[model samples]
Target: MRTAFFVDGYNLFYGLLAGTDYKWLDLPGLLAHVAHVQDPASHLVSVDYFTSGVKPELATRGIQSKEAQDTYVRALKAKGVQVHYGRHQLDPAKAPRFIDKQTRPSRQDKVDIWKLEEKETDVHIAVSMYRLAARQASLAEDGRIDQIVLVSADTDMTPALRAIREDFPAMQVGVILPHRAGIERPPPGSLKDYSHWMRRFITEDELLAHQFPARVPTRKKPAIKPEYW
Candidate 1:
């Protein structure tokens, strides 16, 4: 079974790897482990990772995040993962204006802050999945891309998954929830409804096991894991 993987980088980070020491991940290695366990015969066609650059308006933290992200992206590209970029939009209107009762006294006005929302990543993932599925469907008779795997717990992808399943009934649509092993709940709504199979949750151990080296020596320069990461 030939397979292509679509990963929601933010979703995977916050859902599983955030606050963990596994931030420096090896995308292809993790997917290879997944493929080996799910279908040993599965041949990797491609891996599309969707994420947005950190918002520069965030100042110091943002700059640091961007540097770390850049290193990680380079590492992923070196390992043959296709990186897709989306823009980060700052929404000032959504920023909190009132002091939270839980954190502080209510007398003072809150600071003006920009909420960074990732734009077009979901659309990118959806379009890539659909386009790849369509192209592979044309060669389905030759046994190309037997499965399309989505690595997300976000329900927004449900529509695209449905479209792929409806448009090409022969190809299998699967989901891999990027969460811890014990919290096994699938995403609610159409995603769960459309998924033909749900792969196991990505484990903490797996993330630890499949990490890029601290110093990845690329041709141009060494891509090292950020000290803060």
Candidate 2:
């Protein structure tokens, strides 16, 4: 049996470690843990990670932590995070404007974060979901793809879930809430189809058990300072 997992990167990271000490939970490590939780009967058939790159303008205000984010994301790619870059839209109206003071003119409402939004993270997720569902349908038509696990809460995925249930009658769709283990689901209209929802939360202990701390493995401190001299 085969299975595919789709992840909303920002959604899972924010929700899971919002206030937890596991601020830097190991990305690759967590997926391994999830694979184990999903099924020991088979190796992770395919792991697909989807997310948009940080916006250009947010380079300052520490909005874009490309170094650290990339480090972690790189690890995932090495272990397998098929990242898909999304487009960033700029709304000039959002840029700061100010009235002149004297002389020529002066405007000082300087905000560097020009734009920020995953314009298509959800769309990418939906596409992947449907693709996997189609794969499952093909499998069902034959006989493969046992269990499908999705690590996301965004209701946009509801339709994909619906299609899987309706089309691939043989596959099992499992929803894993890395953070919203116990939170309430979105109200009715918000989620198109959730009648067949099967939910479960990832326990804190589980997260702790998978911490892949971000730290340099080998680094030595300076010998000593000569301020006294």
Candidate 3:
């Protein structure tokens, strides 16, 4: 089976890679392994990673954080992963303050803050997945994508999966939540409802085993692992 993978980079970072030693991930290799595990016949065709560039001013390490992200992106591109960039929108906003874990947020108690959002990522992933499916429908059976795997815990992708399931009955849809094995997070029911199969979590062992080498060669300068990563 020919398979394609769509990754929500932002979701994956926060859900699985944050504070972990697996920052130097080999995206294509990891996804290919997962695909093979799901089906021994699976052949990886393409990997599309959707993410927004890190906002330097908002990042903890400021410029260094941005550089690290850029390096990783370059490395991923070098490894045959197609990266699609979305923009980060930073805006002044007001929202109810978080008082305590047990206390409900009240509109009366609001605070001003900078709201940073990754724009167009979800829409881009959805459109790309649908477009690929549509294109595959027009291609010869051998060239068509047999399965589409979504690597995200975000429920926003549910509609896209549902549409594909409805329109392309022959195309199999799978969801791989980017949750870490030790983390306790409920799987999003909506995503599972639309997908043909769902992988709940990525083990630390898999991540550790699939890391990129200390340096990855690109067309120009090699992409080296960040010192702080």
TM-score of 1: 0.86
TM-scores for all predictions: 0.86, 0.67, 0.97
Models ranked on TM-score: 3, 1, 2
75-173: candidate 2 lDDT, tens digit per residue: 555555576666666654444444455443334565444454567878787777767667654444435566676777677778877776777776677
**lDDT score, candidate 2, position 68:** 48
Off-target runs (Cα >4 Å) in candidate 1 are 56-60, 94-113, 140-143, 183-186
Model 1: per-residue Cα lDDT over 17-58, one tens digit each: 878888998888888788778878877778999998876557
* Residue 61 local lDDT, model 2: 24
By summed lDDT, which 10 consecutive residues of candidate 3 come out lowest?
135-144
User: Any runs in candidate 2 off by more than 4 Å, and if so which?
Assistant: 28-43, 56-64, 92-115, 136-143, 180-197, 213-229
Better of 1 and 2 by lDDT: 1
